[model samples]
Target: TKMRSNGRIQLHSEDPHQLVFEALLNRGTPGVIAVDDFVLKDGRCDNETYGTCDFESDTCGWQLHNWERVTSQRISLPATDRSTRSPSGYFALAKAPGGRMVSPLKWYHAAKHRCLRFWFFISGTSSERLNVTSVVDEDQEKSLWYGAASEASIQQWFSASVNLPAQEKTPMVVFDAATSGNPGSAVAVDDISLGNTPCPPPGSCSFDEDTCNWYNAGDLTNAQWYRHRGATVSNLTGVQLDHTLGSKEGYYLLLDAEDTSARSLGSMQSEALTLGPAVCFRLYYVMRQNSGASLSVGFLDEHHYLDGRATTVKATTPSQWTLLQVERTELPPMFTIIITGRTEQGSSDIAIDDIDVRSGRCTTAETDPEASMPPTTEADSPATSHVTEPMPSKQPAPPEVVTWQSKTTAAPATTEPLPPVVCKRGEFKCRTENTCIPGSLLCDGVYDCLDGLDEKCESGAQCKENEFFCVTRTPSACQPRSMLCDGQEDCVGGSDEALCGACPAYFC
Candidate 1:
């Protein structure tokens, strides 16, 4: 089959066993065209019911155009299927000269929220790509996710979660694969599930499989968080088992001091989160005796600036994992949790696992009074402890109060002189926090201010001619028009990459 320049498909056959070849073009109505002995069915999986497919025995009601259900033993592309992790397990596979496999149409309401989670494996060349799209009315389609094999390893199976757009009509989910004619290229998908929830809840991580979106701040020159399962390479101080599973099989984020010089600091930041009234952050950590490492947690505004004093742990305990909880009543609306690990002389390792963020204040028994102590004014603190200088202010000064609790003595609050803040022109000053960000970053779908004041623009606000407004996101956002169809989801609803032209136009 060949795709013509006029956007029509031409089918040809020369085999003697093939007697006839017929072509029919429906000019008016749009529909699926079946050839040979193939047939198309509704294969409905309703919206109210949970939809899932392991692909163990069959396609599980999905309509295959060029995709096929095969076992890993039969195809050497993916070494093992994610569902069963065995060679005999079945999975959907697509090869070169690619086509699409689509799910049955399901009724979706405009108000309902759902997420599609799946594990996909891609191996071979960079020319192979997979796209997940939502199609409605047989023509209109929105890209949910698209990527090439270059972003992942050949044998590793990566998990993905995409939020399905809410549409009033019946929409079919499509998995379209396009590949170069290289025989080495292939794509595999398995363990697909659709649930009525968000893809990932904010600030929750176990590090059992992936980093859960937590990323290194890249501030330290030689130190960063490493995901490890068993003991450290040095086998000198790190935890032998993870806190989550209490075994060597489970993974945790470890900061090994053996790889870096003494006093090196490393930090990891979580994804952005919106905090409610009272919030509690909890995690499990291990700090061995003579480790000479201090662990601290702090808040970073959306612009990646540290907001307030961090909760630091100075003393080391036994090799066992310890639970720590920090509860705060006053916090920025949009902030990210930053965990910093600093190594002093003789430091060995510091590991953390099972970080969680939730609503409501922590119980009295769980809250530690020492956790609320102000950060030390030591010069060797992590870079995240230093807040950006604030812009110059002419407003009236208010009395600042500082208070602390001690078992031996009670101290009264004392007023101190406020430091002058200065910011360059075209920078927006955060009202509650002493930080400044570029004015252009305001109303850009990201919360650049600690108090979220930068995102307070009215809906459908006007943008420059070279900008595209993201109407689907709350408060809307303006982004550069060049981001459209860039194979990256810049807008909240993926509007930036949706409705792109077919790939065959360029690759063919």
Candidate 2:
């Protein structure tokens, strides 16, 4: 027997074979179980629903009966066109702001291979926000997916997958949608299921889509790395990585530490990696220098053990692409790579790209002294560094200087008065923080201030009249409306694209 193009099965044999085929079909093939598909029957939403709304459960199974805020007579369907419905209809959150829908809880034996899959529709002027969370345990709720408001011309369907943890029972899932009070702000969901398959982590990210699961910590408010493709930068000297035009590669991660206050320290970490027998990590980095700026790269073991190497280049080290490589032979249960940058004043513009984490070990057994440094008193540290000025024209570019010792020789303390700070070319002083930042960054999308003053520019005031305001952008700077939803994040927190369905834009 074979499947025909006309959508029928052709049985080459007769009655005896038909009996056997029917029996085999009845037994069926083992596959993923259908947990919940969110299908509505007879266009009716009633009490015995797989998904229940927060409002009256008897009136609607998967959606709110009415807008709690508005007195409208018409009931809203998840989508305008019934043809787009997954089966007949889908569960849409209430149109009113803060609407929520809870999926019925289910019990499942926990294993590493258990995974969740779902499809959702997002569209309208005030595209609604959707949050998908899994309740692994009472206190341990994990956010598996988040989608921002979108402004697409038509409804869009997105399929998402999430990997469940290795061991746990009573796993339940929930879908919540936020409303914007506009018909265009519609959030609908369908096709949710569970399977015995694990989702694999991305082996690399080029800053092409979000931060690729990297999280930021340390000095988050005033200093940190941001995904850079196009947008401007400030307070930079010498040859700095292109903030808007991009690096040698089109997109890269940037840390604009130049022009900040006294001391700025920040780090970006990758998602947890379940290592193979061995692992090797490689990345390319470029750093513009200042007197006290330094960058460190390391990995955190499953035991929260930090093994890192710190290196500081000369103040005049040429800004060019440099490859940094490291590997670990003895693999652990899980580990994450962390890149930390430190600077006194804003003197570093660092860019990183082509992060490749693969299954392999280092070519050579290289020992990092900083990785094994014992905790010691700062008083026993090496003497402060005394850098000599390089001769103009006669001085050739010096090689990058890496300090792997656990303890770095501190720069001599300054006794001279902290004079009125000066900003570099094409920069301005954040009078409040006394940090100089780029003119383009003044209102590009990020808040570049400690007092939150940078984002305070009014649309018709500090921000150009023609520019649009990212209400949530720190320092709430102005950006040309053309940059909004043009496929690249121009606003610091990515508020520019939030209304177009990209979300939680990265900011330090």
Give the alpha-carbon lDDT of every model: 0.58, 0.44
List residue ranges in candidate 2 displaced over 4 A: 1-203, 219-222, 230-232, 235-249, 259-262, 289-291, 307-317, 363-508
Off by over 4 Å in 1: 1-200, 219-222, 261-263, 364-508
TM-score (C-alpha, index-matched) for candidate 1: 0.41
For residues 1-508, write the lDDT of model 1, one tens digit per residue. Answer: 1101111112333554433446664444222334444332344333244366777756666888888889878866777787667798888988567889898554334355565667787765556778888787666887766656554422445555566655577578898887775655678889777755443344666776556556665322436687888887665565788867778999888877564422256677765555544667777777766456777776754334345446677545666566655666666655667787776535567778878766566654433322222223344233323211111111122112100100111121254234324333234567788765554455567876778977775532577768865533211246677966776544433445534664422235
lDDT of 2 by residue, 1-508 (tens): 1101111111233345322212222123221222223332344333232222222112233323332311112434343222123233323445556665544444345655454545555554333567666676679876655654331212334444455556556555566667666754566555444545343233344554344445463222335577665332543533334322334335667766552432255567665465544666655556554345555555554322342222233333445444455555655545556676665545556666656666665454443321121122223111221121111111122112101110112322344233445433223346677765443444445676677555454332556656876432222335577876676544333445544542223332
TM accuracy, model 2: 0.34
Per-residue error at 130 for model 2, in Å?
18
lDDT of candidate 2?
Answer: 0.44
**How much is 119 displaced in model 2, in angstroms?**
17
